[model samples]
Target chain A: MASSNTEPVIIVEGLTARYGEVTILQDVSFEVYRGERFMILGGSGCGKSTLLKHMIGLIKPHAGRVVIDGVDITRADEETLHRVRSRIGVLFQADALFGSMSLAENVSLPLAEYTDLPPELIREIVRMKLGLVNLAGYDNHMPSELSGGMRKRAGLARAMALDPTFLFYDEPWAGLDPVTAAELDILIRSLNEGIGTTMVFVTQELASIFSLGQRVIMLHKDVKGIIARGTPQELRETSSDPRVNHFFNRQAD
Target chain B: MPEMNHRGYRLHVEGAPGAQAAVRLEGRLALEDLKALMADLQAVPVKMKPREIAVDVAGVEYLDSAGAMALIEMENLSRSLGIPFELLGVSEKDHGLLCLIDREALQRPPLRPESERPAIVVRLGEVARRQYRDVLEIMTFVGELVAALAYCLVHPRSIRWEEVKFYMKRAGADGLPIVALISLLLGLIMAFMSSLQLKQFGANLYVANLVTIAMVRELGPIMTAILVAGRSGSAFAAEIGTMVVNDEVNALVTMGFDPIRFLAVPKVLAAMVVVPILTVYADFFAILGGLIVGITGLDLTAFTYIQQTKSSIRVFDFATSLVKAVVFAMLISGIGCQRGFQVRGGAEGVGMSTTSAVVSAIFLIIVADSAFAIMLHYVRH
Candidate 1:
């Protein structure tokens, strides 16, 4: 396995995204080293989704660059971007599961669209992915029927369907109960060990980020960007930045 | 008290020719006094146009946030009443002070000159919105449905048929009573209203032809389609709107399933399946209404009215209406569900989407009925 020191799997350099005159993200530079479970932490409207969109090539950077797997995604062709995306799994915030589709259909959608596998083989793979997420028996369930955690787990199952080397989880633990959140944390760790995939997470929930992020990157709302990045423990004791201190001091707010 | 009126300021509110209201005030004429003066001006006959409040604030000094907020309120109220509001006869120092405090209000874009102003973009939001007439939209919807059905066949279990049945019950079954009632009411209404107009000519028997022709050929299908659209169309929007607000739509998208295909497909299918049945229910009630009108108003027998209806109603007429109802149903359900899925906000979004769905469905149903009528006219000719 290539260590993070050898080369970074994802790099966002001085990236900015603007909606009309309002700049949501400004000049952010960060790297997700190979095999690292990277986390981006901020409150709502802090442009975390905007950052994710830029990193995943869904959006073009306004004034900078995003390089994923040695490709300059800011100016890359659609085919090139698709190839890069095919190698990564994205578990979006809200899980983004289709309400019209059953659990089995939702999990198997990616393979149906992108793979040449036969229907029987596809079904088997879908079953395996659901089994991994502990949603195997609920294949016929609609998204409306699933509990919030089960829906997220189902989304995770779909993400794992592609067997990608890099995974991005956007607020995987959000809106989940504490027990379900803990279960997601366990799933994240197990998935990391089992697939050895590089991971990046965006979340405001501090406990999961501290427990799951191999390295955490703190994004602040004002002009300064990427204010702090470090191991969770290192951030807890030695961080001197007031924003970092306030964030780590861990008030209920 | 009379001496206090004499010391009060002489204010000239300029530009509003018809709306000059005088204020009676007392003392130093501070900005607060001016504000009170403006408040009193509201009682004036400034209903038609620009209101002019000329305050002589020369006697007083200083304006703060409260003064500014009051002036802003005045500006807003005057604008709302279609009256121009201007301050005049004020000392230069006080004018500058007032302007400084109400800078935002002062700098708003003034009404444009007739030649330079951009023409108002006129949108009906209601007028001329028939799904059938908009061939491009119809084709796009059909294309989307085809894609969804194809996807379903490849992933049969992806759609929970039971959930679809749940929605179907709401959209189709629940809609029947309302659709039936409206169709019945419509038939009676058309028969009575047209008879009242035609009765002046002593042609009460023609009410039979009129009701039969109008109900079976036009009003029955059209009204039934609209009623269903309002009821079921709104329901579809609410269902999809709630799903969207709750993030179920996003979850589907993340899971590699297109929400349009998943949520929209089954709804379109259900509508395509149910609209014809609803139309049949509507037709039966409408004919019944016509029969009642014929018996009571004209002193005619129910037997004669039925005989006339049976003889006059063509198989083509019935089929055409059914065909129109199916098309209208598609129009109502498709537009409603599509608009619902487009909702963006949370709870308010669900409400907005539901309202839009009903409005669009009704509008589209009317437009579709007319277009179908025109088509039938041309084909028959």
Candidate 2:
């Protein structure tokens, strides 16, 4: 991993997002520094997913800017935006694997499309990526045949195909059992440590946030912006806000 | 800082006695440049190899997973030749991503070649078995639909009257203008063609008889059925397929409601009611088309043409066609609903089911029409 630098890889300034008449997020500003595991935490219906989408340039915010690697993605031209996007990878909540394709084919898609490599080499890379997720030799299986946790793992393998410097995960362990969820957490932490890739993860799982997140921001539906920001241990021990306390303590508020 | 470029990837090799060989890499190291990198590395002789190889990556502007794998593969090759390999000057970002690559998996032998093709007989047998199973499944679906209909008849209040009305408007009322226009054009074409043959025999007066019989007995019912199959059959399949994919059908089952009754019944009933009505309109327009030819080509009056058509057609002819229309409607909507319920996977599944619904409905309609024609022919004789 790169040494912890003062320079941030991503800068979101006064971002306000809306869908038609309904406002989703307002004035959401944050800087994601290089080599940090940044976690976005919130309850259901909060704008965590919306904020992630804005960061990846999937959805444009109604106001303000998101600067990624020195380029303002909000105002970048299609070509420039595409160049920026090539450096980042996202795993959606649904896994969103192409259902018709086998696991190997799914993982090989980005490499095949973007590079002029021999088919033999691409096939080898696909195997290595799948192996990273502990899915070796399951390449020929269709996405529909995999269990939910396995499917999510396959999705992660596909996301890592390009070896993106920045990775964003949306609820990586949402539907998995406790054991599988913990296994996924361990995999994520190892990947962060071993590869030193910058990660921005959106999750409501308190256990995962506490264990894996280096820095955390809690979004609230009522405020439509971040209400708490700190290291997970700091928030748990020193935060004065009742909601933050309630969250860390697992109280029904 | 000596500049070196080879196949879009710059490589500078430095070797000294009793020292590790330093290979400086620059430019973008990605999948596109893998072939050149592999060839260049292979060109180095194994006899002169040192104990360790230092790969300097500081000048490399960009590196992806493929590039990482290339380095790993090179490392494995060096180890095989009794040499240790190490990467030097890797940026923090590149190092992080490169570490995620599982070196053990990368060193595995290339994937086995695809399996051999199956024998022709085996392939044919498999297809036949699949089609047979599909037929059995459709038969079971029809039986379930009939049971649901029987239940609805016994309990009149169970029918979803609102959905029936909605489908009737969509499949019947909304379909009216297009159906009428197409039927009218068909009638005009039939009258115009037959009039030419009749006129050659100086028998233009018989045009009314030919047009009336042809439209009522065959064209009117068959054309109406085909139009409805294309319009509403595909819609039923697509709608139900989407519901199946969305798990709405499963939800209905869990809620103690029969999916066939709640979804398919209304569509079937609406088509059954509306298709016959459209056939009658088609028959009327056909007779009018024949009358136009009679007035213009045969120098006959409107009164004369009407009298000829009325004398030539019987009530049995109209009743037979209407009966055919009703049966066609049932087949179209039933097959559509069945195909929808068969959908699996995702959006592509829905699309496939929709296309199959129209094709199967049309095929069944034509087959049923042939059976009706053969039975009617024997009875008439």
Candidate 3:
């Protein structure tokens, strides 16, 4: 691992997703540099989630490829998809944990799903994850028992359970308290420093995006293709996309 | 899927010399005239064996049993008159009508016999071959479910015995009291109903025999099973179905654990283990219910009732009932788990799959129980 700034780790070329007669994304192209906490910032219904979905291989693009770490995940088979997906941890919008299981169980799910580790080792990994989220003692609590912040933390723990190379957080600050949000941002920062993990945060939550993202790719829905991609300060001062400022509109510390 | 209309008809009249015909029909035929011709045949003034009586029905759109019965009567009349009768509109729908009157009407003439038959099975086979994976998937799920249980025996720790225990308590023990109560009341009701009728014939003592025979041979095991199936079986479906919809199954799959081995084996094992036990309890309560009836309604002593039950109910009969319970247990739980794991999409899909599981399981249980009863019947004889 270089552990240094380098070429983009993710590149989307001429990407589009279409229904019968409607286009969701149109010939969109972008690149995410290595070690950059690059964000795709857009308002709701602006294809932000759709773009993120394409990146994680949940939904395939209509006409382009998602090249992640040099492997094209656009048309991957199950094993390939699993491998690619495991490398990219996704925090789904609603925290898609298995409801029947407890917090520790949820965090351990990916590890349990993909590893051949003994139960004892799996328990240790789960303990380690919960501990990272400051949820060290809520291991046996069901998802329903956790508050919004706690649930998000548990979900984060699960997402980070596999020690993914890249983390994708979808609106992680949407429903959390400011204190919790700030704590989460610090945790994310600590995680980045500690593991040197690359991150792609998809959010219109301005505070979280600005505080967490090192660079940003703003989506502009003009009659043409995507309008801009740049660093936060460069985007804040000089970006021409009207949608760009709108994403940063509700920015509150 | 089916449509109906009431509309017009027309009649035409034609026949041999001196034959007079009048139509009782009142409307214009949708197209050509056939009623007038039937009237022509009915007039029959000549009282002669005409070579043939002919009617064209090609324009007829609607037909009634009256119209069809008239045709039947006219055919008999033709046999009497020694004239061959002919109907022109021999389309498929018309042929169906003719078949209703006389099945031979649908039979093909020698030249067209093979041509008219459907290519349904061969075409269906081709379609099945093309959609073979669906068949393979179903087979695989069923195979894996069975293998999962087989795996459980050798590797019990791999199966989550705790979850199975949880479901068994929910599905079996908690539900057992109600099931037992209902079976008991059912035995009392059957005995009471039969006692009213049999008392008229002064055969009150045989009521014990009736209750014993019916409960052990048919009602106790079947009713108790059906109650449990509807109660606990549907619960199994809904619970597991919810897990499936919530991506728990996918989570399991990604974890390198076979969901069937992880999920289904436990539920299947629990139900298979518990249902027969529940059936035995139901049997005990039902006998108790009949014994209560014997003392209060029939004036027969409890000892007499018990004696008659013991003397009449054989070990083989009890075995048959218990064996049926065990089999029904397997069927209900297996189908319930199968449906649960097969859930697709949201709340509506889970609900539908649960309903289907109950219906299919109940029907299969009844059918298998009937077959088992018949085999036992033959063996006993």
Candidate 1 residues lying further than 4 Å off, grouped into runs, are A1-6, B1-381
Look at candidate 2 and give me any clashing residue pairs: A195-B96
Model 3 accuracy (lDDT, Cα):
0.72
Best by TM-score: 2
* Candidate with better lDDT, 2 vs 3: 2
Off by over 4 Å in 2: A1-3, B1-3, B6-9, B15-22, B26-32, B45-64, B81-99, B107-116, B195-211, B284-312
Cα-based lDDT at residue B88, candidate 2: 86
Better of 1 and 3 by lDDT: 3
DockQ of each: 0.01, 0.40, 0.01
lDDT of 3 by residue, A197-222 (tens): 67888887767766777777776555
Q: After superposition, how far is residue B9 of candidate 2 from its true place, in Å?
A: 5.7
Highest-DockQ candidate: 2
TM-score of each: 0.46, 0.89, 0.43
How much DockQ does model 2 earn? Answer: 0.40
Model 2 over residues B1-381: C-alpha lDDT tens digits? Answer: 233655667888777534677788888787667777776664442544665788899998877666777787888888788777788898887887677777877655434434468999999999999899899989999999999889988987999999999998998998888887887777777778988888899888888888899999999999889989999999999999999999999999999999999999999988999999988988888788778778887898999889989999888888989999999999999999999999999888999999999999999999999999999899778
lDDT of 1 by residue, A1-253 (tens): 2234546878889898887888888888988887678888876677887888888877787899998889998888989988887777899888888766777788778877776666654665565566667665666677777788999999988887766668888888879999999998987776675445689888878788777877888887785368787887788789887777777776544
lDDT of each: 0.71, 0.86, 0.72
Off by over 4 Å in 3: A1-204, A207-253, B1-138
Give the range of the ten consecutive residues with the poorest summed lDDT in model 1 chain A: A1-10
